[model samples]
Target: MVVNTGKTFDPQRMLGTMRLADVDRGTDASGNHLIRIAGKPVRWALGCNFDVWPWACPATASSDAVRFGGDIAQLTDPTDTSIGMYVGTNAYYNGIFFEEQPDGSHALTTDIAAPHYYADGSTVITGSIRFRVSYDLMRTDMGIPNPETLTSTSLAGAVKTPTGAPAAGKFVTWHDPDGGGFFIEASGFTFSRKRLLVDAARITPTRPALARTVRKTARRGVLVHTRALPRGARVTSYAAYCRSASGHVVRASGAPGSSVVVVTGLRRGRSYRLQGGRELQGRPRCVERAAHPARPSLTLRPRAVPAARPAPASRGRPRGWRSTPHGRCATPTPCGWRTRSRDSRMVLNDSSA
Candidate 1:
């Protein structure tokens, strides 16, 4: 009879009629036969050549009168009847064994750590085991400074000034961060940004026509005539000196449109010549003789005039020298007339003589 044990079962047609008496059966003369059964193709009986233990027999052995109800069959362990065993291959046991930890964590046999059993009969698995399909790690470090902070002051000690009084319509000093320290200028004076690096005491205004004449007189140790000066002009002082006739060796004081500077030290009643420009109208001539007989007559005559010497032809300035209209030389040379040309040369003649 077929027993339905709630599992799939297919019996061989040829073996369906086999009875207990038809199959070979053997037993140990003293006790039961030993039999070990696994999920192999051939069925084995106790005392068979393939049986591992001849004294024990599988519970499913025919002689044991074991009948499976359906496709499933449960067998009791020969050593311990309390435990049940199922017959299957690798496919059944591959996912079967597992352990749970005290923290309710579970692991399989393939896990890194072995499954553990607790005193409370609970099983646990410990240790970390990573199964990563993909992993990536990144790190970055940088250094940056504050944008609003000022680092240094390089122009701390710089100075600047106007070489003289700022003239009308011209910037006394040009725009420069380092000042005009190294700049050599033509007309204007050079200065730094905040103060003058060089002394500007020698710089003066352009000489006016009136100042020219008085300057010549002061050089001769004579009283310069300043009555015809501009109304607001002041006579500062007069400077004078004595030199051989025809020789123009002298120094003068007084600035344009200012006071005449007079020099004190001089010998009285000595024949002397007087010369002046816009402030005075006269040529250099000897003073009138003195009146006292005891004193030698200080007779002043027109100083012996020296013949004009022709200027030597200039070798011409080097290539880069600047030519200026004011008859002064400046670097980074300027362009202007060098000498009087034959066409523009003038000759003076006495018409009334």
Candidate 2:
């Protein structure tokens, strides 16, 4: 299947492959024509999708498969069409291409295979080249009308949520280029694949971001807290890195696209830098960002002051001592009952005398 798209399938070894030309087979003694397929050429069926790359001619609906998406095939003879191994349609002279539409959209959407008959005006046999066709909705949106050079770095399926918070219980679902769906149950997730897509879906019920927030003290009783988050920009896994005691750069990964995740047990006087992106359910990854300055004061708070209480009544004054106008006890002097006044003067009671 991959070979039809001009790609090598390395995961599995090819036992072998063979090819055929128009003259390879001729009318036999019975006047019946013969054709051959080398090795087990992957068969193309109607309406079934096969994952393929951009710019490569794609296998499509066979001429005989009437029960399918649509009957779109191109037919050309020696003059109007040339035949060869090629990608995009070129006037049907050599390679694959349907007649151009008024909108400049040209395509070769039907596979040219054997075990099929040529219709008088409908189907005709072409050269043997298993190729691929471009999908209208997904590819052109990827900007492959004329076939662009492709790479995992160049694909664009990651999209920003509508410039605001996702509605309650709503989340973005990640899909691969092949139309398979995946998502992080509680955190952001990333996967490695080009031509991938991430879109938002709001169902009847919403789900929560399963994030893990941590608050731990790596320094003297001071907890440098970090909150593991579920929602943010980007759709890949995230990481935080800090210098460890062994002078090594230690890292901690949080939920994919986690908005807030705490990396704790960090030493004092050490700064941490964050990198990586939110993750989905796949292996591919990209970048995103979340940042904050060093704030290490969560364990201490101010204490309240207590009000002053009234003093207990002084016990019976010593013998003749009595209370004076000032806040002091007065002693009887030889001249008379005397006390130091608030004005810092000694006053004598001559009337008592």
- Which candidate has the top score in lDDT? 2
Question: For candidate 1, lDDT tens digit of each residue in 1-353?
Answer: 32222222211111110111111112344444322221223111221122232122222222212222112223333332111211211100111122342323221222011112222224221111111000010000000011011112100111222333332111122111222111111112221111112111111111222232211111133233343222112223333333334543333454434445343222221233333322211111211112223422222222222222233448365442223545653455322212222344321111111
Candidate 2 — which residues are off by over 4 angstroms?
1-90, 93-236, 244-248, 268-353
Distance from true location, Cα of 312 in model 2, Å? 26
TM match of model 1 to true structure:
0.14
**lDDT of each candidate versus the true structure:** 0.22, 0.27
How well is each residue in 196-315 modelled by candidate 2, as lDDT tens digits?
A: 122211110112232322322222111122333222212345445444335645455555434454554444333333332223321112122332333221221111112222234576
